[model samples]
Target: MERWVGKVAIVTGASAGIGAAVVEALAKQGLIVAGFARRKERVEELAKKLQGAKGKLYAVKVDVSKEKEVIEGFNWVKKNLGPVHILINNAGIIRNNTLIDGNSQQWEEVLVTNVFGLCVVTREAIKSMKENNVDGHIIHINSRSGHRVPNIPNINVYPASKHAVTALAETLRHEITRNNLKIKITSISPGYTETEIIEAAGLPKNNYKDIPAIKAEDVAEGVLYALGTPPHVQVGEVTLFAVGDKS
Candidate 1:
């Protein structure tokens, strides 16, 4: 929105999929956006293409799974771009395995990336916002599985991680209100989306092909809708999926 023009926004896991789309949209809205991902070159490449947009995009190489790296990335953003006005916690991962006999390493990876990583980034971003006395917004890109377990198999601990996101948003909201902070927290859960996550998770190719899905851009639009509202109007949660999606 015009109110946040020239302000700073951070999008994690921003090299591709939902993260990429969200960051690009924020940049075009005139926010100084930073796209953080381990595949820094991918974000940098996109940044190059967005050079003529209303705002600037910076690519920061960060693997959100590590706390030290996350801290450093936040420091860079603070020192260079002032404080965070918006934060899109979009970094997440899913492994194709069942919980009963699933690979422990894979589950650990998912927990680290989806749960712990998100918390660390949020802490830093909220810290920046509080320190600067800015009323910022934090949006968590969750999944429908967070609300209900899907019928699909081998979703592993993905749903559990997302459920944590659902609880986290509420907890953060409570904390904000108790602390008398003006910050807003929202969780936007999207159903099966067309993204590299499916392929990267090694889901069955045929299943992905048959599943009706929404575009990553659609989720990005929902994010903008949340950010476009007035400060007093806190858009607590949004759930979006393709019309034909039965899941």
Candidate 2:
């Protein structure tokens, strides 16, 4: 944490939920944070509230699903905030449809945003880190679904996309190791987090209310725990779940 003070960090899906929480936590730690999301206004509002904090916050309009927008956002950060020292790939989505008889568009949307979007952001961020000789850290906001399929229904390809994330984290680590790069990659998987994502996925509001769930802030705390480790310590993965959650 002390070493990261005055450094730059980029957090995707930062308009709200876990991403927003992470942004606020890092800013308080004196790290310049760039919040990237399509809902630029929301992040702008958050930035205003974070004024006078130990660090600063900037809002960047970006839809990680769009390659061009991702590239532009990274370029802007490099030009204004210098090289990226940390990247939190927190953008993800879940559609209400079953793979047995689901809409192709919905499936594509999940894959594009959850899988492809993460890859694009990682690539661009790594490029900046390498060119600048920064030993950056990349954290993926994965889900319990990434490790195993949940018992929930109509999740469609959401779990599949997350499973891909599980693989991506390992693949990126291997790639970095092969090149002898000091960059670190980690995957943080949380189970049934209380966020708008569940409602947006078309689940009944009561469904989440009745279940044991972790707050978005709890997950943010996990992010800080990972980032605060010693330089020689690389946390490969951190999985969190509510105590009451059976699975």
Candidate 3:
């Protein structure tokens, strides 16, 4: 059975990397997928490709960091496609700078985009989910940096925000449990994967052999796996490291 058939899903950062992979995977599973990104060109191209292939997909231009845009994006999905049954808070940014050398703007950008953006999207999406009394699933693409910062003292802000995300995910899980909203939430901690973000970070391009980088599709598979489980069954957390990227 198609796990996402008839379900509507929202994937942020869908223009590239794991975000794109997740959108593509969900669409292939028969979900009505909405792809959101700040720059619409790539997402639009992906949507056109999906449409041409007779797949269910929609592309929306949004900067997830903006509250109004986040609200409008999810509302658009609800009104046009359907209530969002799934949300992948996959939009994030990385800043490779040390405490003293780091740009203040970069710090703000990292926190606002990775943390605040997540909150806005989740809040609006949950409003719709709760109003409809639907038990939906939210998957956050967090990083291992959340758990243990790399030895490299640079990239401080990136890890700090990710750590916040890790804590936020756990706190949300607890809150939802106590309130009995029945919504399922989980976070996946992924080590270095071959993506544009890494390349932008000045990492090598897609060389997994040395460090064991996982593919974006690998993360997408995890999302689908989580979505497939029965509501009563929840995978609280999943941590994936490329086989050789050892912890």
Candidate 4:
């Protein structure tokens, strides 16, 4: 955390949920954070609440699925906040459907946002780091489902996208090692977290009330933990779950 003070970080899907939590936590830790989201006003609202924090938050209007938008956002960061020292790939979506019979449009939407969008963001952020010679960290906000397919309902292609994330983290590490880049990759997989993604996907708020769940702040703490490690110690993966979470 001391090393990252005054440095810059970018967090996608930052308007709310885990993304918002991470933005607040990072800014409090003294890192200039850019919160990218389609609903820019929400980030701005959060920014107002952190008026006197150690660092600042800039809201960038971006829809991650669009490569052009993502690239532009990175450009803004480079021109203003300097090279990215940290990238949090937290923008993702899940649909309220099933594989046996699901809406094609919904499936495509999920894939484009959760999988392809993540790839584009990672690519641009890494490019920024390499060009500027910054030893950065990339944290993927993956789910426990990424490692194991959950038997929950209406998850549709979510688990598949997350599984892709699991592979991507490892693949990125190998690429970094082969290329001699100092970038570190870590996958923070949380189980049954209390977030709006599930409710937005048609899962009623009551469905998981009795079941175990963790708060978005808990995951944000885990992210800080991974980032606070010594430069030579790369925390490859961190899995967080409530005591009774079955997922």
Models sorted by TM-score, best on top: 1, 2, 4, 3
Give the worst 10-residue stretch by lDDT in candidate 2.
202-211
lDDT by residue (tens digit), candidate 1, 1-247: 8999999999999999999999899989999999999999999999999999999999999999999999999999988888999999999999999988999999999999999999999999999999999999999999999999987878889999999999999999999999999999999999999899978999776765656899999999999999999999999999999988876
Tens digit per residue, CA lDDT, model 3, 1-247: 1555878889999999999999998888888888989978998888777874424878998999888898888878888987878899999988666687667987898899999999989888788888888789999999888898775535768888999999999899988889889888989888877788965665334333456678898898888888889878887778877765763
Give lDDT: candidate 3, residue 111: 94
Give the worst 10-residue stretch by lDDT in candidate 1.
203-212
TM-score per model over all chains? 0.98, 0.98, 0.93, 0.98
Provide the clashing-pair count of each candidate structure: 0, 0, 0, 0
Query: Which candidate would rank higher by lDDT, 1 or 3?
Result: 1
Local error of candidate 2 at 127, Å? 0.2
Each prediction's whole-model lDDT (CA): 0.94, 0.94, 0.84, 0.94
Give candidate 3's TM-score.
0.93
Give me the runs in candidate 2 sitting further than 4 Å from their true place. none
